[model samples]
Target: MDSVNFELANDGIWTVTQLNRQVGQLLEANFSRIWVRGEISNFTQAASGHWYFSIKDEGAAVKAVMFRGRAQATGFIPKPGERFEFRVNVTLYEPRGDYQLQVESMRRAGRGDLHEAFLILKEKLAAEGLFDQGRKREIKPMPLAVGVVTSMAAAALRDVLTALARRAPHVPVIIYPAPVQGMDSAGKLVQALQDAIARNEVDTLLLVRGGGSLEDLWSFNDETLARTIASSPIPIISGVGHETDFTIADFVADLRAPTPTAAAELSCRTRQTCLNQVDAAFNALTVSQHRLLERAGLRLDRAVACLVSPQQRLQQQNERLQVLKSRLARAASAPHDRHAARLALIRAKLAHAQPRLPELRNELNRQIQHLSTSTQRLIERRGQRLKAASQTLEALSPKNILERGYAIVRNEDGEIIKNALDLSVGERLAVELGQGSLQANVLQVHALL
Candidate 1:
């Protein structure tokens, strides 16, 4: 604001090296590891084992370096026009102040954008439940025939044929050729799938292609191809690439094989294995039949043990009848014997129970005589008692008392007057004596003083 301190500010000015170093540090500190996708250009492998290249998209290009350590790990030699995705570090060259990327690793554009698209479609179909294991149909272990969808020129077809011939030569193989690469390859693949399905000749369909770079294999990543595979009624075995490669078709298929040959091996059993199984089944059937015949023989032996001739059966029945006849004769004689014993016992009991008439008559006479004496005694005793009672009653009788010189006087109404006051003077009364009765009249009544 006052005088400019130009000399002082100049003294604080930073050197070029320091400035570039600080800027580089700042760039590295601010930007983490990043990803870049573009066509590779100006690629050179330095004698010092470093890769120098420029990655440019439609609008932008950046210098990039992959050191020997990272470049060798890529396992791919970079081509100028080829596209690649790289994981890189942001940095600036200290000397030139030029910003560039240090590549950590590289992936052929195979799993980059198309892989992302593949992932997106896979996730979408997965969410819609198209990739559900339950929705996938089972591939027949013993298919009647197999349909192949691939280019006739593809080496994968030859590999599949060799595998099927070696493992199961009897199984039929039908080839539906389609371009395995190029712009319209996915459409041809879908048409081939439709053709195989319409014919309905094969139980299993192999959708196969040989391994290639991601761009070369992009047809297998098509959404239409993936949808066609998912919707196909035939069980599809997706053998689109090497073991390390994956495509959208793999996720939607009923089965995914690492290679086309592997898909053939998975589809059916080997001829030797089939023969072994058949021989085992035949041996088991033979053993079962032998055991069954042995059991039948044992059962027949037991039946023979129980079998008796008709003559023996009749002889046994006759013996039983003879025993029964002897028992019947004994049973018939037992009642007569039992009756004889019962009659003997009854005779003895009757003899014991019989009454002796003479003795009974004697006893009856004796009882009658005793009863006569007892009756005479009872009558005499009764007579004496009656005489005594009569004497007592006569003594107690008023007539008897009158006979003893006492008299009963009655009033005129024939009531005995108990007191002299009961008689009125000149009242007539009657007096009854022991022998007679008399009527009297009271001349006067007197009160005893």
Candidate 2:
């Protein structure tokens, strides 16, 4: 036991393939799957349908490959230098022993702080019915007054004031200043909103704030503030942050605006547009009144004209009655005399014409007979010409060709062949006869001069 011999065998250097295989096996055992977030660089698509790229962060980088099949399934190719989060499986090429990631999927990360928050809040509120179309109140066309709840120091307040002044100066604004951010912001905002409602100072309340980071705008996400906004007696318009950013207040409020400025614009109607409409309506009413008055004046003038002097009217009526009496006397005496004179004249003419009456009748009858004979001849000539034209049309008809013993030969595709050169042997053709058609194949073609 004390003299036991120890022997060490010398082995030859390992080949590249063996070393690579060992490395690959170790990598497969250690990192089977992983997720990495980095900027893509040196992207290339080979003719062999393999994608090669490097995913690098500030400190380090790693090689990546997405086979054609996986890349195609992704629906879109990632561009170089674009930042993405990738889910990949770690592996080493057995032959080369290179450490690389085999990417399975990818997605964009951190679009912006506001966008991320917007997405999160939107998903959360959508489940709560705050954005339900059924629950949304319709804004009145003309409100008596509008309450503005915003940070007095905010530039957004100034923009709103300017817009309201220019658009509808008649509608007054009751401003309730609130802290838009930081620790005390939520409490101040809720108090301001409650005050505005308690005082009944406005028909509508605009809760607005300028855009800021998620942390800077954390007050808007307060549960108390959201509940307060939802229970507000007056309709609330929550306009906070940029178009991409969303908050709990946006969902709880009656209306959501992309920006504070947009909220102000939506809160009230423009003075100029309203004034123009009212002026138009007033002008139309005035014109209608003026037209009515003119019509009434014209009716009065006509009434006055019709009420002429009674004495003059009586004299005019007497003159007309006298003329009518004279006319009636003359009309009563003239008709009998005219009738007697006409009877005498007619009797004299009849006596003179009685001898020639029989001769004239005979001459008229003869002339009528000649006219009938000539008309019969002309009609017969026209009938014969018409008969010939009809026969010519019939002779040229396709039905006539079929009646005659000739038939048309058509190809399978319905094209007619007039000459032997138009057909080939073994081609399918149709022969038309008067009664039916025969399907046949062209055995041969022959030409005739």
Best by lDDT: 1
Clash pairs for candidate 1:
110-214
State the local distance difference test value for candidate 1.
0.79
RMSD per candidate (Å) reads 55.9, 34.3
Off by over 4 Å in 2: 1-57, 61-124, 294-449
What is the Å distance of residue 85 in model 1 from its true position? 4.2
The Cα error of candidate 1 at residue 395, in Å, is: 99
Cα-based lDDT for every prediction: 0.79, 0.74
Pairs clashing within candidate 2: 167-271, 168-271
Write candidate 2's Cα lDDT for 1-449 as tens digits: 12323233357567677667666666666666666889999999999888999999899999999898887655346677778878788888775667899998676555444434555665677688766767777665567888889887787787777677666666778899998987788899889988998999798888888877556777888767877877777888888888866677887788889887788778877756765675676567557656765675676567557754546655665665567556555666668777567556755754553445457557756865675576567556755765675576456456677888989888886656767888889999999997788999888888897
Query: Across residues 47-135, which tens digit of lDDT does each residue of candidate 1 receive?
Result: 99999999999999999999998776554476799887888898999878899999997766756656556557767987988778999
